[model samples]
Target: MDDNQEASSTKRLWGARFKSEPSAALKALSRSEPSFFRLAPYDLAGSRAHARELQRAGVLDANELAQLLACVDEVEHAFVAGDLHPIEADEDVHTFLERVLTQRLGPIGGKLRAGRSRNDQAANDLKLYLRDKARTLATAIGDVQAALVAQAEQHIDTLSTGFTHLQPAQPIVFAHHLMAHAQAIGRNVDRLIDWDRRSARSPLGAAALAGSAICRSPELSAAELGYDASCENSIDAVAARDHVCEFLFITSMLAVELSRLSEEVVLWSSRQFQWVVLDDGYCTGSSIMPQKKNPDIAELSRGKAGRLIGNLVSMLSALKSLPLAYNRDLAEDKSAAFDSIDTLSLVLPAMAGMIRTMRVDVDQLRRHAPLGFTLATEVADWLALSGVPFSEAHEITGALVKFCEAQDIELGALTPAMLAEVDARLTPEVLKHLTLEAAIGARTGQGGTAPARVAEQIARLKAVLDKQAAWAADYRGPRC
Candidate 1:
């Protein structure tokens, strides 16, 4: 093509309404903002639904509708095979896709946008993209939970130290600690379910913040796209971005939970703890230090949590000043939201792999389980059960812990004379509760760290994972 034809070909779909092309600064911002290549399939799906809406409203004849559908199908296929790419003059995804369509099928393809605006079209595309991504993300989280539950199942009886404020405070089964993270992940799954249900509604027919004057058939498009219902208010449908914020919050919260667990993985794999040895395949060696094998996966997962939070905050900032109608600012929403999903897609399975392959040193865990006076709470409870008031029992246990610490003796190795030094009310029976195994077994309350309770909790987590796995596996629809 000649230079004039090439320049004209680069012109935007909305350029005819303007005197000349948009300013270079606006084009630069527009190019970076939407980043809608990822949203291409979603945009096409929305277009297919909208095309039929147009046909039903008699905006397109049967022949033109058939031609448009055929052309859009080819565009979708080229997009999927990575052959289609955007031009510089292509303003956004919508403009780029239209350029491709009009290039293939002439002006007939232009009728597909009848009675619709980029406002509702972009909003609908985001809903579709998030709905699919959320389902996949929920499944990735479930896989991580499954990995945790599997590891916990094997170590349900292995003893370990439970900490509060980064200090050892109690003795519990190691599986109990793993299951705590699994439970947090289960709640994250719950949050995804709630978020997906809210996002399942369609916003396609809400043209530009108002109901369309012609070619309106939201219900038809909603059903074609597998939405449960259309948005109740057109303006709210076009302008609403709270769903995006809520989705990012769920992702951010899930990241925080994983970061906490990742921190523990780092601590456990350290030489000081030596409680769990990460698989060599999952860990990395240092450049200079010959003895270094670092838990980089866990560390990176922890570090990437900040990225998720930043994405959430960036979206909130984008939504902060926008008015009810759609603004150019809303186009900035997809980049961060899509990146958050992409971040989790990388983090979750790698995290699961690290957990599933790690080696647990049961002997080491059991050995140090009772070293830090972790059984003090058990002794206090035993004293209380022996007719001493809990307040007095608490004081007695505190004195005993202090004495053991000062003498460099473990609570279990304390002499009867050492016990008598604290309180004459103490008897040999208290010694029974001083052992780590005894301390772990004594507390059998619901959700406690006892082995049996840990087993029961694992079973419960498996049930939750089972449900979420089915949800993840079945991508047909969630209306069931």
Candidate 2:
């Protein structure tokens, strides 16, 4: 068929002026396109608002506007209640809904598209969708942070060996380390709240690339859609995807933080560490080995983080070279945008569950806390407090550590005579800094891992989390 006949053969929403319909493979790609499907709810909202404006402008009488809103509501209700499905010829959600409305409401339904284009409408839908999803993700992160805080409070005085480069370095409690993850999650919560506020601007009136001079007031549409303001310029409104990029970055960073905690879960549950035991409900058994119970939840979360990072990279790559104004390329942006939110939504709750259920082996923690001469720093600090030059004290502590290692004894296992062999500064009084408890207790500086400091941290974190909870709740809170 010739181009005009070809275009006429399968009628698309943007089919006019096109000589031929897109190639079959290209046309089929629309079904997989997520932008329109996800935008349906917001698109209906925009149409109702647009219809009222058209009536005010005398394009539609009051009866026509009322009829349009009633039809829009019917389509929305059917879609939500699972009673509506588009026909096979429907190419995209925008066209599908418009087709359904046109079929039911006759010519008046076609009048609804007089001053708007899919360009601005899709952008509007995206902002609405992400603003709501960001709030949900923030609340999930807060839940995970709360789990960590609750666990930390339980372990405020439980001592464990803190590692540097996977080797024992000093003594700290389980509460201090877990709360570090909670603090990181708190930042993620902040980012989501911050980004949601910044991204709530509306782009509905930016029809096509520029705008229609006679369209309804964008301010009114924006207010109805819950946006803080309308986009200042039409071009930037539809053309900009920086908000999408920033959201992807936030979710990707959140995944990385969760992966770090997952790694710890894997390590702590292992035979060598024995620091924690995962609940049977959250773990899986090996297929071939009857004796094996694995940390699959943590392992899977760690693997999924790579996918989240890849999604951010894909989103950035999609937008990097697109020219000004909207492009066909942007249709691909939805997958990563949606997937990042989904991935974090799934991972955060799993992490929170694991944190809530794990058993901490206190005896193992205390026993391991003093192993590998982890208290060398404490002995050096004691010498420094005894009025010795820190450099000399450091050397003296090193000598003591070496002497202990030569005899195959820990720093705390050495006697007064054995201590004197290393240096005169290594007195029986130095024994005060030798136990894991004393080593942990001696450091009472702010932000230290000392038991008292950890208690203070528990209080501070609760305050931060309670404030974050309020914001996340507000973003998705109750009406009125």
Number of the top-ranking candidate, with TM-score as the measure: 1
Evaluated against the true structure, the overall lDDT of model 2 is 0.81
For 58-163, candidate 2 gives per-residue lDDT tens digits of 7789888888899898888887776776555667777777877877788898898877888887787777788878777877888888889888988988999898
Q: Provide the clashing-pair count of each candidate structure.
A: 0, 1
Clashes of 1: 0
Per-residue CA lDDT of model 1 for 1-480, tens digit only, reads: 221134358646565767766787876866744456778888888888888888888898789888898888888888888787776676778888887787777788677778888889889888888888887888889888888998999999998999999898898899999988998877988998888788878998898888887757798889888888889999999899999999999999999999999999999999999999999999999899999999999999999999999999999999998878888788767887888988999999999999999999999999988877888898889988999999999998999888888989888887778788889988877887788878888779999988888888888777877898777676643211
Task: Kindly give the stretch of ten consecutive residues in candidate 2 with the minimal lDDT sum.
Answer: 1-10
User: How much does candidate 1 score in TM-score?
Assistant: 0.96
Per-prediction TM-score: 0.96, 0.93
